[model samples]
Target: MVFMGIDIGSTTSKGVLMNEEQAILAQHLVHAGIGTSGPAAVKKELLAAAGLQDEDIDYTVVTGYGRRTYAEADSQVSELSCHAKGSAFLFPDVRMVIDIGGQDAKVIRLDSHGRMTDFVMNDKCAAGTGRFLEVMAGILQMDVSELEQEAAKATQTLRISSTCTVFAESEVISQLAAGAEIPALVKGICGSVASRTAGLVRRMGVEEKVCMSGGVANNGAVRRAMEEELGTEILYSPLAQFAGALGAALYAMEKAGKEKEHE
Candidate 1:
């Protein structure tokens, strides 16, 4: 049977299709998220890619910021638990997970069994999130995707001491006006995000074999900075952004199997 999982995040929607064997069949990501057309688009694309229709899916699970709003899901799970499960699936030895999404950041500590032991989250502000990077990218007149390349050219790292998004914006602008190199400024912006996120990680205590998930994990500069700040190598997968969705799908598979057993 096919099981599906969808993650409706603040800035993106991701879906995964899997079977009883736990092999992924297809994965899709939409740039638009909840309150937009992202949910429908991701589901439609995922089904098409897997050569299946919605009715073929035995069970559906949802997670992320907009999970509760998605009516098609058979069940819903918290993103924190989902992240831990997915990260463990990707890196069986992973003991920690750092997920930086559009508007929030999370640090989850997992035991050897892949169960979540503790987690710290920052949902109160946009200081260490993908949204913050988007704003910084806008102010720098470059796309978010360009940040890594630009940051790599930096001769030195500049300091952005503010943890408030507004203050950081003002500081970046001020530095630009003061003739600070854009690359250096970009590196500083990434560093600021890393530093802030690192604080969250420290709250639960650092552990070995850390994996990063979510859209921001795609940012190499941020990952490098995170590694530096935490003093450990960070692991990530091309499927990093789909970690939550994949975890949800795994849950769906398990639930579906239980139903079959009961039948």
Candidate 2:
């Protein structure tokens, strides 16, 4: 049977199609433009990529910043729950999930059975999130993907004192004027973001076999910062960015099976 999942984040929207085994069949990622047309536009693009019309889906699960944005979905779910479900589906041993989205960051705790026990998030701040890194990237004239590799080449530690994006930008300018090494400054900025992320994860309580999800999970600098602060290893998924969508798909599949069983 086929299942579909849609994640409507602030910066990006992702849609996925999968089978009962959770094997991904097709997926699409698109920039989420400003306005009220979040899920509708994203779903249309995803449906096109999957080579199936929207009605062909067995069930559809929606999640992320715009969970309610997908009014046509069979069900709307939270990003935290979706990440837990999706990560566990891929890695059954996962006891923790760290997800960094465009505007928020979350760390979810799960039981041995993969049920969510508790979670913590920083939805109000950009300090520990992808947005923080994006601003830093702009200041450093570098991309997040390259930040970690550069950080690894740093010869000294550079300090950044501001947590606010605006203040941080000012501090970066001062650092540049002081002739701070570009690599060192970039490393410090990433370190600050990771430190904030570690703080959120601490609220959820650290556990083994942690899985990292969301688009920012693709960043090595963020991963290194998180691991350093948390003092634990992180497992990365190639499909990290689609965790919410994958979770939705899996949930839709299960719900469909139960419906059929009753019939």
Backbone clash count, each prediction separately: 0, 0
Question: Pick by lDDT: which candidate is best?
Answer: 1
Best by TM-score: 1
lDDT of 1 at 96: 96
Q: Write the per-residue lDDT of candidate 1 for residues 187-207, one digit (tens) a residue.
A: 999999999999999988899
- Per-residue CA lDDT of model 2 for 1-263, tens digit only, reads 77888888888888888988778888777767224565676677767777778678788888888877577788888888889999998789999999988888888998999999998888587777888878888877886678778888888767665367778888989999988998899878877877878878887678998889998888777788778889999999888998888888888888888888999
Whole-model Cα lDDT of every candidate shown, in order: 0.93, 0.82
Worst 10 residues of 1 by lDDT: 159-168
Residue 261 of candidate 1: its Cα lDDT?
Answer: 96
Question: What is the Cα-based lDDT of residue 194 in candidate 1?
Answer: 95
Per-residue lDDT value at 65 in model 1: 96
